[model samples]
Target: MRLFLPLVITFICGIVMILHFFIPHRPISTIGDGLTDWYMIVASAAIFLGAANLVQVHVHRINTKARNWKYSPVVLIGFIAMMATGLLWGVEETLPFDYMFQTMIVPMGATMFSLLAFFVASAAFRAFRASNWRATLLLASAFIVMLGRVPIGGMIWKQIPIISEWMMQVPNMAGQRAVMIGAALGVVATSLRMIFGIERSYLGGAD
Candidate 1:
């Protein structure tokens, strides 16, 4: 009954939402908007549940003295501190929440990305080996793009920047559009499968 009810609701909602786009009738549009608001409420609840689960898991790890458990308390402290700050001060620009986000979170994120750059460069070096014609072409394109971005590139060859720009606008854009279309089609297929109850994995073994 639990699985059946959800599947029915999913099918009905999906149909209504799809129709709402084409029909454009007042009541159908109102229903679609109301469903969207309901979705927001459900999403907020899910986030709250997820946060609670995170804290629970961390606290259990700390109590058990598990491996690398020392970090669990830090996670808890940061979570609580952020929650308290937001609740008390409001997340205004002058508030502690905003200050911590700007000073602490932003720098940490930037540092993480900086570290990732080295790993990405290592991977690119491995991938750009010129064993095959395709690999050679890719290596050349990457070299041109990287060189074009710096002052030394223009010093070596004035046309490097123009070639790099053309490659990005033409080949890069075509590849990106192809990838996006494939992803959109996949999403549509998955949504349809769910609406038809063919994808019951989401129902927690209800299959």
Candidate 2:
């Protein structure tokens, strides 16, 4: 009964959503909007549950003196501090919440991304090994793109920028469109499977 009820509900909801796109009658559109509201409420509750679960696990780890448990307190403290700041001071520009976000979080995120750039460069070096024809092509393309973006490229050869722009506009766009079409097809297949009850994996155990 438990599994059957959810599957039926999911199938009905999926069918309704699919029909809602094609049928724009006032009542049907209102119902679709209501369903979206319900979805948002459920999503918010799920997020709250996840946050609670995170806190519970971290607290348990700290209590049990698990490996690397010293970091758990920091996590708890940061979470609590953020929540308190938002709730008490509000998120106004002059408030502590905004100050903390702007000063600490923003700078930390920037630092993290700056560090990741070096890691990306290292990975790129490893990936750009010209062992085969395809790899050589990829390496050459990457070199051109990088050089094309710089002032030195124009100094060396004015045509580099034009070549880079053409490569990006033509090949890159074609690749992106192919990926989008493939993803759309995959989504359609998965949705049809769920709507027809052929996919019951979401009901917990395999069907």
Candidate 3:
């Protein structure tokens, strides 16, 4: 009965959304809008639940003295501080929330990304090794693309930028469109499967 009810709701909502896109009639549109509002409410509730779950897990870690448990307190403190400041003063400009976000969060995010650049470079170096013809081609293309973005490429050869632009606009765009089309087709197939109740994995157990 639990699974049946969820499947029924999924089918109804899926059908309604599909109809909403095609029909665009007044009643269907109204129902679709209401469903969207309900979805937002549910999403907000899910986020709250997720935050609670995070706190629970971290508290358990701290209590158990698990590996790296010392970081758990930092996580909890940051979460509580952010929540308190936002709830108390609101997140407007010049407020405590905004001040902390800009001063602390932004710099932390930038530092994380800066560290990621080294990882990316390491991965690229490994992947771009000219082991074969295909690898050589990939390495060459990546090199041209990277060099084209910098001033040194133009200084070395004026045509580098032009070739890079063509590679991006032509081959790269084609690949992107192919991937997008494939993804859209996959989404449609999955949605149809869910609508037909053929996909029951979302209900928790195996389909």
The numbered model that scores best in TM-score is: 2
Task: State which candidate, 1 or 3, has the greater lDDT.
Answer: 3
lDDT of 3 by residue, 40-114 (tens): 999998998999999999999999999999999999999999999999999999999999999999999999989
Clashing pairs in 3: none
Error of 1 at 152 (Å): 4.0
Q: At residue 13, what lDDT does model 3 achieve? A: 98
Residue pairs of candidate 2 with colliding backbone atoms: none
Cα lDDT tens digits for candidate 1, 1-207: 878888899899998898888987888999998999999999998998999999999999999999999999999999999999999999999799999999999999999989998999899989999999999999999999989889888899999988888889999999999999999999999989988889989888456
| Each prediction's whole-model lDDT (CA) | 0.93, 0.91, 0.96
Q: What is the lDDT of residue 177 in candidate 1?
A: 98
lDDT of 2 at 141: 97
- Number of clashing pairs per prediction, in order: 0, 0, 0
List ranges where model 1 is wrong by over 4 Å. Answer: 204-207
lDDT of 1: 0.93
Cα TM-score per model: 0.86, 0.92, 0.91
Q: What is the full ranking by TM-score, best candidate first?
A: 2, 3, 1
Scanning candidate 3 in windows of ten residues, the lowest lDDT window is 198-207
Which is the winner by lDDT between candidate 1 and candidate 2?
Answer: 1
**Can you tell me which runs of candidate 2 are displaced by over 4 Å?**
none
Clashing pairs in 1: none
